[model samples]
Target: MSAPETTTTTALMPMVIGEHRIAVEALSVLEILGPQQWVAIPNTPPMLPGALAWRGRAVGVLDLGPALDLPTLSAPSTRNRNAILQLTDDTVALSVDRVLEVCRAAADAIAPVHAASWVVDGGLPCRGEIELDELVVPILDLDAWAVASRRAR
Candidate 1:
């Protein structure tokens, strides 16, 4: 016989990117850093705004706007914000407009995502969703987004 085991729940960390609010897996977020030095790289795709030095390494940053086909922030600055997103063995830095406060909710609190049912501002496909106080926020599918971005280039 085996004793019943209960699963522990952790809150979701949603970040505000441009006009969209997306939450990646909380643990996947390495750190949220204030704007750092960004240097433009010639011949890079629009999705890659620039690269920055972090922890003695050059981490190329991606701008979700163009990559996701979403509306970009009207006025982005060097002082914007960055969310270091890590998945599997891959990691990358994201330049977000701002990050919202951490929200407490079970993963079930979010609605299931569908390939056809989920759609963002630019008709982008989403994987999951959460109903925030004012609006429904979608969870960005980083893996899928990465695949699409590579195809776009």
Candidate 2:
């Protein structure tokens, strides 16, 4: 059987990383599961915090805070909930603290910033200079984050 043809639309989902607010591509998300029981992996990268027994599959959990240099949690506490982002063929499920809402913006909305001192500023493809009044949120590059996490291991 042949796969169905589909048209793609661009939209942004508001997500919270620790205290900072950010906007992520809505298409990158799989599902937002509740606080799940996870098994801690030894000697793994801090970004790849651990793995969770999700649907009989060992889903690699990415700690958004640590991955983005935000404050680390006191412990592995997912008591509230998390947004699971499917990155790179949905093989990895990244966990974020909260989901604010979804909004739409133009691709040209992203602009480059001049500051190149900070590591994140340097690494980002676009600096995101102009802030949207209704959808102003930090842009996160999951690909870069995943790579950094692996190298940190």
Q: Which digits, one per residue and each the tens of the lDDT, describe model 1 over residues 1-153?
A: 898976555566777765667776676788889976677777776666667777888776767776456654222344378888875545678777787777776656667764324345444456678777767777767777667666887
State, as a TM-score between 0 and 1, how close model 2 is to the true structure. 0.71
Candidate 2's displacement at residue 118, Å, is 5.7
- List candidate 2 stretches off by more than 4 Å: 1-9, 67-69, 73-76, 113-136, 148-153
* Best model number under TM-score: 1
TM-score against native, each model: 0.73, 0.71
Best by lDDT: 1
* lDDT of model 1, residue 105: 64
Write candidate 2's Cα lDDT for 6-100 as tens digits: 55435777666666566667777777777776767788766566777766787777665653567643345553455667666445655667775
Score candidate 1 by lDDT: 0.68
